[model samples]
Target: MLSPSPNSIKKAFSRVALVGKYQADGMQEHLGDLAKLLGQQGCEIFIEASTAAHLSLTAYPTKKIETFAGAIDLAVVLGGDGTMLGIGRQLAGSQVPLVGINMGRLGYMTDIPIQSVQTILPQIIAGEYEADTRTLLAAVVLRNGEEINRSLALNDVVVNRSGISGMVGLAVKVNGSFMYNLRSDGLIISTPTGSTAYALSAGGPILHPRVAGILLAPIAPHSLSNRPIVLPQDIMVSIEVVDGREIIVNFDMQSQTHLQTGDTIQVRQSEKTITLLHPRAHSDYKTLREKLHWNEYPSTF
Candidate 1:
């Protein structure tokens, strides 16, 4: 765990970034309100040029997505997990800290609720929130001995067939040793932070945020013996497309790219880490129980 430097954060913040889903539902109304509230706090607000129309305030400077990190002291992403994923990738190489305000359903990455932003923003700007370092994954797809696309994901990286009907055959290997050729709908390589997302949906275990491990889960495997496994974060994992008519990769549920046969995907823990603002009293296990409704059993107490 990284300790917070009180002196470093006590310094005044001059600029703030507002990231939102431009075309997503209800983005305009919420961003407009956030922009108004942020401006009133005497902070210079910066927004992506594409998201400009969503905000009512016109005085705030708007820059392109690539320029966002260089212009802001903090980034407040308004949307769901997808919104956070997009913003996190942009801020990956930078030291900027992100606070996500959820606007979509099942937001594990964008954990903060929209209704609480107004209440939390003040404390966040005042540096009262605790920051948690979340690891990311880097995935490179090689097709026919050539690099097709390389991307980073905060959640899990998935390789699955595009169509609805058929199952995908994925041959898994770790650090050059053969693991298994899974016959399943898909395979999920998830980080501890992503254990609750697609991995959990595929019958994987929920991992604590501080755990240094990776999850390998077979999505609806044809055989019951093929189950999810957790490995050390330091090991490298490679998934080969064994058999499928067509396959695609889902990076944090943000970007999707097609994969051809004989393609090898190299997965490893990314060097870059995302910093999240967790309120002082927030608990990961508590979140799971609340979100999953796990303790719904009737008891005579």
Candidate 2:
């Protein structure tokens, strides 16, 4: 639940969009139920075109992902965190809030469980929820001083060797100043929202989503002295392949592009942000403890 300030004004939502994993078991049934619930609240429901096709649902209005911009007040994503990640990137900068329903294991972003959908959705539609604004990273791949590719990531931007298996040499710079050079399997430049994802699997620290910092974690560095670093969000980070090795750059694990020697990747905080709606009782610590299985006692305790 969001604690409202004295100056805050509550806005009523009348248009909602649904995005889900196509063809997943029981997805159609869940979508049907959700549509009915939203309709009862006097809200206009829209479904993503592909999802509507998959479920053969033509009763509600349908729109393409890109075309649906500005036409929706909120988006309800049904699936795991991956589904939320995709939708978040697509709907970035649109200022449309997202509510994720957990349909997969270890759903950190998708906080609402399947069993609780009936209970939580009503509260949410009634405006009894909290809106958490999360930061996003903007990455640009530059070659010869020209922008070649640009992407927005809700998680981390990873640079690593593509085909060859050995470690690759990388040079890192922060705010146009030399930081360090290292030979490692890869590098992960992650947002606080991403700290719990790939960064954690690579032995990086878990950062609370509210923390305004960027984490730089090296993956299997050849030298033990090359450690992870956390920097303020306003700084710009540039990474270049120094060993003349071909590498790949991945954005939020959703898209990838090849990088050659001397190709530079720049990452900085995006001007855009994603608004995540959570149930009033949502707790970041409780979600972490449950998802990571932290502090669990044995039967004997």
Candidate 3:
């Protein structure tokens, strides 16, 4: 169902890695079936070590997620967006591209459907696909002007109250200029790739991946006047936890750490990036329409 990009050269993908959702029931059969499919394509299949341990995938070689950078040419993910987000963060700066076989409810990043993998995946491995490069956010937590924690978030960086009953006061600054001071549940600083995630849920505008902008949405701001704003992607945003009962910071909703009141989170564009491979014919609007169920006509109409 997917076609190769006409503009791309025929690249060799002799080594392919398969990462599957280990928590799924009957995942062994799913991974086995896919491994068999890739093996038939004359490819050397490498299973992720963590996945190999969880699933009974001993038939293929295994590689750790931390060191598989150059050994593998391409990675095929068999999970939903959450899995992709985790892998994407880990694979940042690897320069290795990824193709996803969607197995989750909302497959924004993992766009390919499992049912279509049999038909669409082979063409992709054979070097017929479009490469969509997405940027990432690099965040560092500074406690007393000393770096304490650092992480990369492909989706968003959320700083909010830890418990159910409390408000966190935050001071926001963009590019060294004071932006605002607010008391709210927390804040969402998201990349364009993250606009559709928590940013959208928190009443933030959806920024297209191509847009070089970062979205800032306050969670339950005490003042209704506090509105979401989009910032230049290149600007460095510094948010300091002023006052709150308990504050926590999250990277891509995957890794999180508790923070002190004086902690300042500095977020900037990461030098590392992620490359997602899709069919050459893939359209952003089409994915949006299908995934979001847009442009539907009423039965009465």
- Find the candidate with the highest TM-score and give its number: 3
- State TM-scores per candidate: 0.88, 0.93, 0.93
Stretches of model 1 off by over 4 angstroms after superposition:
1-12, 24-26, 53-57, 104-106, 295-301
Each candidate structure's count of clashing pairs: 0, 1, 1
Candidate 1 steric clashes: 0
Worst 10 residues of 2 by lDDT: 3-12
lDDT by residue (1-301, candidate 1, tens digit) is 8765433344345588787877777887787788777765666778777678655546677877677666778888888777787778778878888888887454666677887778777677776787888999999999887899899988889988776648888889999999988998899999998998889989999989889999998988999999899999999999999888778889988788888778899999999998888666767766776689876877763
**Local distance difference test, per candidate?**
0.82, 0.88, 0.88
What overall lDDT, based on C-alpha atoms, would model 3 receive against the true structure? 0.88
The alpha-carbon lDDT assigned to residue 238 of candidate 2 equals: 96
Sort every candidate by TM-score, greatest first: 3, 2, 1
- Off by more than 4 A, model 3: 1-11, 104-106, 299-301
Q: How would you encode candidate 2's per-residue C-alpha lDDT over 1-301 as one tens digit per residue?
A: 9754422433367788998887579999899999987776777899999899988988899988887668988899999998899899988888899999987575888999978888888789879898899899999999888889999999999998866657888999999999999899999999999999999988899998899999999998888898888999899999988874668999998899888788899999999998999999789999998988875978687
